[model samples]
Target: MLTINNLHARIEEKEILRGINLEIKPGEVHAIMGPNGSGKSTLASVLAGREDYEVTEGSVTFNGKDLLDLAPEKRAAEGIFLAFQYPVEIPGVTTINFLKTAINEIRKYNGQEPLDAAQFLKRMREKAKLVKIDDALLKRSLNEGFSGGEKKRNEIFQMAMLEPTLGLLDETDSGLDIDALRIVAEGVNQLRDGKRSFVVVTHYQRLLDYIVPDFVHVLYKGRIVKSGTKELALELEEKGYDWIKNEVDALEIA
Candidate 1:
């Protein structure tokens, strides 16, 4: 559902992503793994239309429309959901209110009538139960004083509420415990159907054990150096990224 071609992005005159080319189809899950400063997160931010990054070249097309040409909110309305590594804390906004605002905003953008309060609350309770998010937690201020695991679960809860066509999960497993990870992964898995896709960006392979990406891509120095199935993730976890880097360097030199 998403196609990126020769993508180049920079922040404050410093380049991050260089010639990133990836194509994601519906119902497919792709995992991007790389060490620090390898531009994995940068790719996610650029794709989500974060204003700080400047796209110098390349084009991203989502569902036959030019994605880069749209604003960030417009991108969300087009069915892109990005789960940030650090979810922001809005002290005055309850989680339910924040989510309701987001859902209504998206609906307005998509030309759909806004959900009534009763309908919205009904859907909220159902999705919250689906993600196993406690009703007590949803009543609190958004991410305010929440534990790391709670924040992560809240992110997945939001995802379940929005039901975006494409989900970009960036470092979702970073601060999650095993229990939280499983819950989040279950939420993601439940949403995986023929009409949705996911790009999971992470450094370690542990998250892949639960998500089981259809494709695993090794990103290095701003580009994907290798792409394979879930087996590649296992091999990387066993042999480390240095081995993959050496192999890639050898192939380039050959």
Candidate 2:
């Protein structure tokens, strides 16, 4: 569903992603793990077409199209959903209204008819149930006065509503409690079918325990330094990233 080749990205004059190459098929879940400054989140941002990072050299193809050539909204319309680590709050916009607008805009971009009020509300309630979001919570302003866990759950809720073909969860587990994490994971798991894919970026292995990625990749210094199965995450949890860092440093010296 996604192909990335020699992906080099930079912010301002400083480089972040040196060269990242990853290929993911439909229904496969890939977990990207690395320590601080390893460019895990940078890869997610670049893929999602964040304007701050400029792609110096590389190509990302999504569903046979040039993904890097598209704008952020275009990427979303192309079925890419990015779950932010820190979800922002719009004090004046209610959750339902925000989602209705976003869903309609994406539908319009995809050349589909917009959902009517009843259709949209029914879909919203169904998706909210999947994420365990309360009706009262949805009535409030978007993420306004919500707890950290609530914000993360709302992100997953948005993902559920969008039904994107490819989901890019950027540190969705950050600041989430065990309960909230499990709820969000459940929602993601429910959406995991043969036609969807996910790239989960995280610093720790705890989140992988719930998500259970098909592949685990170690991103270091803006490149995927190591790739392995789910067991790799367990090993990282046991051994930490120092082992990977030492191996890279040793290779550099050699």
Candidate 3:
């Protein structure tokens, strides 16, 4: 569903991602684990069409189309969803209204008529229940004054509402308690179909326990140094990132 070949990126003048190559198929889940400053988030940002990152080299294709050519909003319109690690609070926009606008915007982009109030509300309510989002919280301003669990829950709620073809979850498990993690993973699992895919970016393997990945990738120093199955994530958690860092350093020396 997604392919990145020799993908090198930079922010300002500092190079971040250096020759990253990855291919993910539909119905598969891939996890990217790396330490801070290793360009894990930079890869996600670049894929989501964030403007700050400059693509110095390489190309990215999504579902056969060139992804880098699309604008950030265009990416969203084309079925790319990024569940941000830190969700920003919109103090004035209520959650329901915000989602309505987003859903209708996407629909309009797809050459479909906007969902009328009744249709939008019906779909939103169904998705909210699936994500276990409280009706009261959905009535409030988006992410404003919400607890950590609430923010994560809201993210999944939005994901369920959109039903994107590819979901890039950037550290969704951070700050989430085990119970919250279970609910979030369940929501993601529910959305998984034969055509949908996910790229889960995380630091800890605890999240992997709930959402098992088909391929586990270890990223160090802006490149994917190792790729393996779910066992790789377990091994990393047991040994810590320093082991991988040493291996990468040794490879560079060799």
Q: TM-score of each candidate?
A: 0.96, 0.98, 0.97
Residue 17 Cα positional deviation in candidate 2, in Å, after optimal superposition: 0.3
User: What is candidate 2's lDDT per residue for 150-242, written digit by digit as tens?
Assistant: 999899999999899999999999998889889999999999987899999999898888888999999999999999999999999999999
Tens-place lDDT digits, model 3, residues 95-146: 9989988998999999999988888889988998877999999999999999
Q: By lDDT, is 1 or 2 better? A: 2
What stretches of model 1 exceed 4 Å from their correct place?
249-254
User: How would you order the candidates by lDDT, starting with the best?
Assistant: 2, 3, 1
What TM-score does candidate 3 get on C-alpha atoms?
0.97
- State candidate 1's TM-score: 0.96
Candidate 1, lDDT over the whole model: 0.91
Worst 10 residues of 2 by lDDT: 203-212
Rank ordering of all candidates by TM-score, starting from the highest: 2, 3, 1
* Model 3 C-alpha RMSD to native: 1.0
lDDT of 3 at 164: 92
lDDT of 1 by residue, 1-254 (tens): 89999999999999888899999999999999987888999999998999999999999999999999999989999999999989999999999999889999999999999999999989898888767989999999999999998998888889889989999999999998888889888888888887799999999999998898999998987889889999999998988889877887788799
Query: What shift in Å separates residue 213 of candidate 1 from its native position after superposition?
Result: 0.8
